[model samples]
Target: IAHGEIFLTTGGRSMDRRQIWSAMKRLCQKAGVAPSKVFPHNLRHLFATAYYRVYHDIVKLADMLGHSSIETTRIYLIESGAEHQRQLERLGLVS
Candidate 1:
């Protein structure tokens, strides 16, 4: 926010968890998305899942996420069963 400090979350402010949650809540309201459905971790997980899916490389995903171990990266690689089911159908494996 100042000359040297950096912020990972959006808006470029050094926000606490509550502030970040409140901002995301307001944004969800404006986007007509249920506030309960979105959060910073959700976005992070989505990014991890999509990145791993595209690259098909756990080590690379780990490096990108700054995880020290592949086991931690596995946590991000997991997705909702519904999403996996959709992918299965897309592959014509469920038909």
Candidate 2:
């Protein structure tokens, strides 16, 4: 299978959101992490946020997230509040 191809085959059917969430919860429990802190949707958010942080390229991010508009990606993925404040501080712009 390729990178994006689905691997599991249950009667040649695709896994739904509940199955994915349950798997994530089980994995998180095994790893000694709170399941609430790392749900499946949270993983998607983390991916978008991390990619944006590393590249700062909204166009690429929008494409990766399958978003039709960069504006939607920006609203969902842009770091603000405490995270934004910390980033500014790290860059010596908050002194």
Task: Highest lDDT: give the candidate number.
Answer: 1
Give lDDT for model 1. 0.81
Each model's TM-score? 0.67, 0.74
Error of 1 at 7 (Å): 4.7
List all candidate RMSDs to the true structure. 4.1, 2.8
Alpha-carbon deviation at 58 in model 1, angstroms = 1.7
lDDT of 2 at 59: 99
Using TM-score, give the best candidate's number: 2
Q: Please give the lDDT score at residue 29 for candidate 2.
A: 95
lDDT against the true structure, per candidate, is 0.81, 0.80
Write one digit per residue (lDDT tens) for candidate 2, span 19-62. Answer: 88888889999999987787777877888888888998989889
TM-score of 2: 0.74
Model 1: per-residue Cα lDDT over 1-95, one tens digit each? 34543334576657766776788889999999998898878877988988877889999889877899999999887778999889889999665
The residue pairs in collision within model 1 are none
